[model samples]
Target: MADVRKHMIFHGRVQGVGFRYTAKYLARSMNLTGWVKNEYDGTVVMEVQGREAMIFELMKGLNRNQFIQIDWIDTEEKETETESSFEVKY
Candidate 1:
């Protein structure tokens, strides 16, 4: 199956925290491919692409815990791509 990509923007106190690192770990463990970066406006933006079920699982897992303060999770479907593995943005 082709990889489905999603552009996600996480709002709230997401910066200066370990949200990015944790997200990277989660994505890696889930075997998803994408990049996660912190926005200047204290928002965390990410481009995640992977299997449908794994993607949904990762998103749900992210929403479950209270590690990061998630005010809102705005996501949009994007174009598909061939992703090798997940990673964290510098």
Candidate 2:
């Protein structure tokens, strides 16, 4: 599988809502390599690099939880950097 990297901006009622934790879990399960963080603008920012299928699965996981009110998910392709593993960044 080809490695793909994306910068994701999740909008809506996401902060303090276990979004980052869920994201980490999803990423780990999908064997993704990158990081997730809460932005000041109330958006959850994530960078994920992995197989396209796994990335799609991770996005699906992100969408399944009710605690997260995902109004929108903005994604953009990014240059893949060498990340050893996925993490929740503070």
Candidate 3:
């Protein structure tokens, strides 16, 4: 399958839970490229790019994390990037 990219806003208890690191690990493990960051409004924002299935897997990994309590995710499709690494944005 072709690669896809998503811009996601994760809501509900996402801050201060090592969410960025967790996302970075998962994304890198899956060879997904993009970035994750904490929002001042208590939400986590991420842009992930990879195969559609891998993206789905990334979501699953995050949802399965014990410390992260995700109430909902707001997402949109985005144009993919050429970056080769996933990162935790400061």
Best by lDDT: 3
Q: Candidate 2, residues 38-77: lDDT per residue as tens digits?
A: 9988888999999999998988887899988889989999
Candidate 1: TM-score? 0.86
Model 2 residue 7 lDDT score: 94
Predicted candidate 1 versus true structure: per-residue lDDT over 1-90, tens digit per residue: 777899999998778778888778889998888999987788899999888898889877777667778888999999977778778787
The runs of at least 3 residues in candidate 3 whose Cα sits more than 4 Å from the true structure, single-residue gaps closed, are: none
Whole-model lDDT for model 2 versus the true structure?
Answer: 0.90
Over 3-87, each residue of candidate 3 has an lDDT whose tens digit, in order, gives 9999999999899888999999999999999999988899999999999999999989988989999999999999988999999
Instruction: Score each candidate by Cα lDDT.
Output: 0.85, 0.90, 0.93
lDDT of 3 at 44: 93
Q: Considering summed lDDT, which 10 consecutive residues are worst modelled in model 3?
A: 13-22
TM-scores vs. true structure, each candidate: 0.86, 0.94, 0.97
